[model samples]
Target: MTKKKSARQLRGQLMLQIAAGRFFRPGFPLNETEHRYTVYSNAWFIGDPPIALPVGEVVASTEMGHISSAMIAIVDRLEQQRPDGTDDFVIATGGTDLVDDLAYLMSFALNRTVSRNHDQTRRLVTGDGAPRGRSANDLFPELFEPRQTVQPGQWDDLRGFMKDLLSLSRDDFARVMRVIRNSVDATRRAPDDPTGAYTDLVAALESVSDDKLSTSVTWDRYDGSKRTIIDAALIDAGQEVADRVRAAVLEAERSGLKRRFISSTLARLSPDYYRDDAAGSIRPPRAPDLERMLGIAYDIRSRRSHVLEDLGEGVWLFTDGAETAYEPSFERVLTLAGLWRLIRHVVRRYVINAEKVAPEPWDYREALPGIVEMQLAPQYWIWQVGGLTAETATRRLNGFAEALIGWIAGQHSDGLPLDQVCQEIEGLVPTLPDGEARTSLIATHVLWHAWVDPTDHRPEASTFIDEYKAVLDAPSTSAFTVSLLSNHPMPTWSADDWVAMAQSRNDTRHTKSQAPLPAVVDALIQLFTADELELAGRHDEAVAFAANAVTELPGNEALVGWEARLVAGDHDPDFDVRTFLFGERKREVSEEPSGHEQSGEPSTEQNEAVTVEP
Candidate 1:
């Protein structure tokens, strides 16, 4: 005797057949001989012989133009695999078209099974046998019909199902409603939820009436009570049940038993019931919906506690008979982390928009408050909770600084006012703690931008130089400070003016009680005028002047280069002497031989010439 097929096996077979035929079949007509076999096999499976015969003729006579070859191949393969002595004849005699209809019918049957044993049935339907064709509607018209066609019996059945779904102990009712509504709302709000499907299901359900439900079935017993009595009863029952279940599960867990009742119950309800399925089971439990009811009880308790604490009140009894208040113990760290994530999202949005339209120097400044308000303060809590360590915090801070610098640079490049940008930078600098590497880096970046701007000749540049000098002089050493000083820009001072200022500072330092070293002043002159020793030609007097300049202002590269060139008689042929003396070119040079001998020898008069002094 053939062993009985499990529901799962039946579902799998039906799905396979439907997918194979509908998805694989070619529209082209089969050859006459092949058509007969196709019709016969299909009719036999569907328990219809005559229909299969005609369909077979149709398949043979008609041109197989639109049908897929893969579908025909699959059908052919299945037909060849029929077991010997089995009732294959039914399938063989069934018409090909009729088989398609039969597959749809099987799908409806599967759906019905799911509706009954929702846990098991849902699993099967979701996994394998689902409806394929329009004919499934014919088998279960009550489910697919428009709003007007639902018979009174079908309405009653639906109402009963709803009541079963909602029925719970009085205490559990509120919790059940809260959970369902919240879950539904959450799903509705989810970015990825299938809105169209949800809307269709809701619309369909709403069209059915619950008028047939008896008034006595409700918690208040239709007594016009402010609160429903049924709700309170259901909640109380749910709490009792949940407490027992929790005790049992905890005990099972403590014993390390793999075969727990909860697990078995969940598994039995599987295929339809997900571990995350907050909806509970479709087949209502024998006891009041305890889990759901208890949840409502917990919510009520929480609300009551909050009110009492806020009011600084004495003990207040709940006349509704809710036994205990609910308290949630979600981890504090987790909550903080969640809050931080939300804050970051908001801050990022604000920063991006602010960066786009902020005018002048205020742009970066304007974005800073939003950043602090939305991201930084909130992130501090996360850090305090050890969600992020000090090193990670430093890295994140550095990244933010770099992004701000980059944004400022981009604005400056686009013709934003340089002084305004510098002022904004100065304003935000205090927010970052002093002496940090990030602070120095940001300062350096700001100074670099100001130095590069040809038009930014404000006295503020000198003030910035003074600030950097102070930072460098501090006992705390910084590589960034060293680099900044080394690259300091020369102001638009004349050669004579720079020389006189250097001598005065030097003399005052020795004679006037050791005045400030004027480090920035010295660095500026040196970087702008440094000399290269490789130049050809030499003179003692000019070399002596260069030494004096270097002594007057140590490491004065610009002055040294000018003096060295004069002493060596290595003047640039392209240099216009008139422009050097009068600040404008007086004449242009026509083609002429360079004043050096062709044999790579210095001109004979080079050593005898007097060096020109500024």
Candidate 2:
């Protein structure tokens, strides 16, 4: 018999077991690492078949692409926090409400075109160190001309800083977070009483396995502070002082946030910590070393500092030594480290013995009505598809494109030029800062059109679709290829077999390329113009450009027939493309060719037509 499957062994399959209520949980002693692995795996996993595009081709996603892009952009922003001891970076003049959303932040941060001295952006005011209108919220927000400021220095234009940040890629976020994640392992340790709970907290707080995490954690010597968090975590006052710790764990249960429960409990014991509306804020606990460490952590998280200097190793010295070198970002990380230790202690002391109430993940679904009520931008696709690679993300985009194009086509607007509807899809994506991410985005755009438009001559649009098939067919295609690393550098696949494989690749792009419905419609117009050119000199012969097309699926039968007849038209090669496609429109499709129509003899001379950008 297979030894009962562990949560790790089942992978995402464990969810089904839980749903069925017929599963044996993996045996205990699960460490924090394993616990984390299980938690995240269940929370973020997406296990289902790929979705088909609205046009019956497979792309991905439904309508939530914008949210994902925003999330990814935010992640990118957070990852930029410096991992060094120096705290200096782009610090805003403190207003977070207007500073939400990744794309908005990125775009706002990166914009250099705006003048910094403008009335709206200038920081210093007349007669004092304040905003001209007292706050950014007030109207007529002007500042004294720069020359009149008390402290002659530049301040960050919060909006401008965000705009600049947008144009970059945050691939480092994943890598750095992965490193932080590794330091946090888990075990499903059974709940015990408060005995040794404080010691456990101390051990947990000091338990960062990697020195790299605390690299930036230092304090100012000149500031007259006590000890840094590291010193507190590692402090040892001897075994004889065991009685000094909390005599017993707070016997409590019945909870909302454990945050509220713990803070309220700690309130009765250490009133200063929860003093007068200062609930959840930090205050020192003088009883034990573990308690002291928790206080240092609470202070760093709330006050954003570690007042004391860190001596070598985990020791502290009270001398007026070197100048303080504190980094708030580092302090935040230190706070988290300390908090995790406190969490371990709380879990063992109070949470373990309390009635085990498993989390209900789907409870958030109750907020869907409210969630959908918010206004969201449509452009960024980062967060919605961050978990996916370039290929999958593009496919999701393709699905969006399909929905858009189908909506347009269903309107069935007669005589409307494809160009008229193509406004939504104009420019391809620019080379975003650093990655192969855009590779599949562009490639899928071309393929999405190839499938949607019945008359895109593959030969003339060579500039836009050079060896696209080869790229599509490459075994290594993925979301990363959209990055700058390897996708653009791919050597041209000139081999005939590679070329042949990619030739029909449009039939299977993993996503929608977010190209506009009108763009494909307009491309057909250009193809019609091109057909006029290809058959220009031959007016006395049958028109048939795609007559030789090997595969003739009934899906676009009418379009194929129209294209073949136009190409093989026996009319003058100078035949007007617009007139032929619109004025003399005949949409009746046929399985076999409309028995060859007479056309002018094929000629070598080509004629100039209007230039249109695809």
Candidate 3:
């Protein structure tokens, strides 16, 4: 019923054709020219031509040692061709010639050998074989070291080079170290999960920026905008929809930040973002603009990508592409590197703006001695701190030098010379009256808390009143040195300044109506603080104060000349600093202790709300 198909219908004709010698070319031994060329090529490339053999048989019969030697010989021939002494290997890959096949094998073997050595080195350095729990930096620190500031002289031609990383002060340098640490951690966990690190890296960025823009998502606006998945996909895929994509990027950026804050300011910078000028330059990115860019980068990393729908609620929900672990392709790694560099620039600016420490880099160790020697008469007792070298600064004096340096710099930015300023402050001393009140103000009020060594425990230690009554019944009458013991030590005090000082101290606890102290009382306190120097029979010290204080008072120069003449002849006896600086009032205050209790341990709020009496 059915015709039987010949199973070998084409086979007989093929056999007959093959037998006829026309179907296949009769083998001709290499003719004269071909034979010589083949012999010359074999001689030149492989040394003496061996008896022809099947490739499998040649490899099988020859020991690996000789085969490897042949491979090395092939490599040497390649290396000899270049004049610069560099090796080059050009393989005719399209052909199935024995030389090409051997070239492929030789290259593979060399690469495999290199990879094996690298694996061994990594195992020795990191003590692990797998990517789990091991960071990319740990395995290849040379390639993956996270950088914040640009290296010095790295890109001199670029404008960003002027604002490079090394320019950061010590404080700002410390802030960006956190970013580097977190980035390393992210890369370490990338094998299994990049999201934890993704989340952390985002948080680190926000932490540095002061996170004032996180709630800027416009639910109604994001839902209403017709930014299709296809548009976001084009950007994610690195397609060049320049104007359309840039507008979308900028719209999202502006929606997150204040409109007034964004403009050509960032654009005029390094031109990493949109370039407004025909000549490309980086625009300065606002905080919100940077944040939105980071978010989009995270999306490209598959975190809340626009491929997911927001459902008009402003929240992107997972549908298909989202996952905890991500494929860390080279493209994603490149995107992240770019994002990190921009983040460094933005965060450095934020730290500088918020910190109020003086921008001037003054060392307190140098400033303190300069102030004492050139400026004030040496009655003020600034504490003796140890040297400011790295080894001793922490162990000896603690952080005192650092604390005081910052405080002094913040107090004044005036252009006046230090010596001139001290002279002016001394000028105000003679204007106040000379009496016991001045002594009390210096010994008990002003100098007590500000000057005395914290380690002292004498009556002067526990209390800071000096008894001038022992030297002279009423103490020598002269306007006291105002500069040494007062906060405004190195500046002139006007009549208005004296009143303002009293008012400032008074304002601390009292209402404005009750803030100003009695001017007469303040003048009286000034009188005896300087009088104590004269009372100790130290006529030289007394004369110095009087001359420094008064310039216009009639007969003041004559009085000072007479006092100096008298003091020149007077050889003062050994002085008792304790009895001279501390008075009977100190003992009385300690003995009385009625209004306030004295305890070794201070209460948490001890004397915190004391009445302001001036």
Candidate 4:
């Protein structure tokens, strides 16, 4: 009833066929073409080693189900292994010839031929195993032009970036591969079809951009308002008309392809293009010009897709060293080369940002000194510690503060460049686990060093005070002590920020915990804490907090001044508060205990239950 299939069908396995141009020149130990290099975990081989090809021939093959699958795996592996954007090995893959075991056996028996025809695989059997004098380079000169030769030691460097590329997710890997394919297509098609090449480059960008569109409806209010007004006007209209109108209004708010394309491009476009640069030439366009240029390109692509409009041939000629020529379609047209550059810039930035690469330990060591020098002035220096957790940051806080104190105190010169002497502080910050809280704490410490360095060439008191006030105005310093010290109202302060600051201060004071700051800075911050309490109409709490501060720093002029203000009900102090707050005061330590250290609670002893005189 049933017919038996031949043994060939039962034990079927296909040998992989591959013909790819070598992207890099050989300068390493394996320079001889006889050695078949195993790559991709030996999934494929380059050159025939076991059975060496005849002179002037090369081989790279594997076993796989299909040629497309095998080629995709090889190409993706090569793309991932590329060290930099400039290098593209595996330049172009040629036609594949699949030969099964039975076919191989039959061919071997007949004439020692395993392939359908030996000549079909001759592309892989070419002279020298290089693309020079080959049709690949002739067709895709743009790729060949920037090809890099792999020197002996540099092969490792070529493999180095693969670690980063390998970290991509399934979706990201696919997206990147798609981009590489489209980019290659663009280059290959550029000579024959400028329009296709341009569209391909733009399509490569759009592939990533499709997922980049903001999900939040940016025109929600406009859509709602228009719908409300139109609905009011259409109250008497039929239900069907009203439903159609509502649907139209709702659909208008959804983000479209053009907006997504432009929005993602602008978001990822390098800031250098926005600077004052050359005009009407190879130099990148300014921001407005770039936006307009991208918009025009997008429109042209749309027209090409929908209406079969071709990008004028002038674009190719102009980009290929031809002189200035005007196309009436655009006043400032971006050449194909310019568009590719912009696309490359955006795509690379996107990839790097997506990678979210952690700052290497050495990166911090090298960059901290320069960052300190630049932000040594009163600006907030946010350390970029990618993906570090808050708990790790909190754990490392004390060590970081102690390190800064030692670094600042260790300076010898009358304050050598504050940043230079304190440069190591920044290095220590990133070494601590990165987190929002960690970065905020680092910013607070750096600002404190800038304000009160033992090194004398630092910002003057007035300047430092003004800068500190400015920082508080923005409220970025999230360290517990600094927030309590500068407890003034922030213009954009959220209630949660205030609550967190208040709770942190309460906890510290309740346990009489040792302050992270120097004694003087700690005492001054305590005084400000009392001032904040007073301002909040907590008069008793204000007096108690200030009285406790007096206990902490007995003879400090600022603390004494705060107590005197409480006693005299002098909310509007006649004295120079700045002088009282910032003037040089020697540390006058009293041997007499203030009757508070014995208990682990704030001293409730107040001079008077006085409120600020209104």
Give TM per candidate.
0.21, 0.19, 0.23, 0.31
Top-scoring candidate (TM-score): 4
For 23-121, candidate 2 gives per-residue lDDT tens digits of 212231111110000000001112232211111111112223111111110101111122342332332211111111221221212211111122322
Count clashing pairs, candidate 4: 1
Q: lDDT score, residue 574, model 2?
A: 46
Residue range 1-614, candidate 1, lDDT tens digits: 32543322232122222222322223422211231222111111111222222111112212222110111111321221222323222122123332332222222211111111223322222222423321212112212211212133433443332233223222222222233333223222211222222232222222221222111222222223423443454465677775565455444443331212112222223222223221322222222332232223233334444553221101111111111122243111111111112122222222222212211110011111111112221111211221222223233333323322323323211121234334444544545566444344344334344334335445665565556544533321122223322244324444444345444434554574422222332332332222212132223422543455456556645445655565567643232312222223222222111111123322223121222211
Tell me which residue pairs clash in candidate 4. Answer: 47-59
TM-score of 4: 0.31
Report the lDDT of model 1 for residue 451.
32
lDDT of each: 0.28, 0.26, 0.29, 0.41
Most accurate candidate by lDDT? 4
For each of the candidates, the C-alpha root-mean-square deviation to the true structure, in angstroms, is: 30.1, 29.0, 30.9, 25.4
What ranking of all candidate models by lDDT puts the best one first?
4, 3, 1, 2
Q: Is candidate 3 or 4 superior in TM-score?
A: 4
Per-residue alpha-carbon lDDT of candidate 3 for residues 1-614, written as tens digits (9 for 90 to 100)? 22422312221111111111112122421111111101000001222233221121011112222011122111100111223334322211111122322222222111111111233323323425444324333222222322212222321222232123223443343344445445534533432343444445455554454323323333333422444553556665554565566566556655542321222123223443333311221123344445344444444434433354111111111111111112223111212323333444444344334333322321111111111223221111112222122222111111222222222333211111112211222333234354333332232222223332335424432332233212222222111222222232333334334333333333432453322222222222232222345555555545544443232223543334434544575432233222222322223222211111222322222111222110
Lowest-scoring 10 consecutive residues by lDDT in candidate 2? 33-42
Instruction: Give residue 581's lDDT in candidate 1 (0 to 100).
Output: 23
lDDT of 1 at 59: 22
Residue-by-residue lDDT tens digits, candidate 4, 416-510: 12233133334444455544444544544444454443354334433434433343444232443344332333234444444344445445655
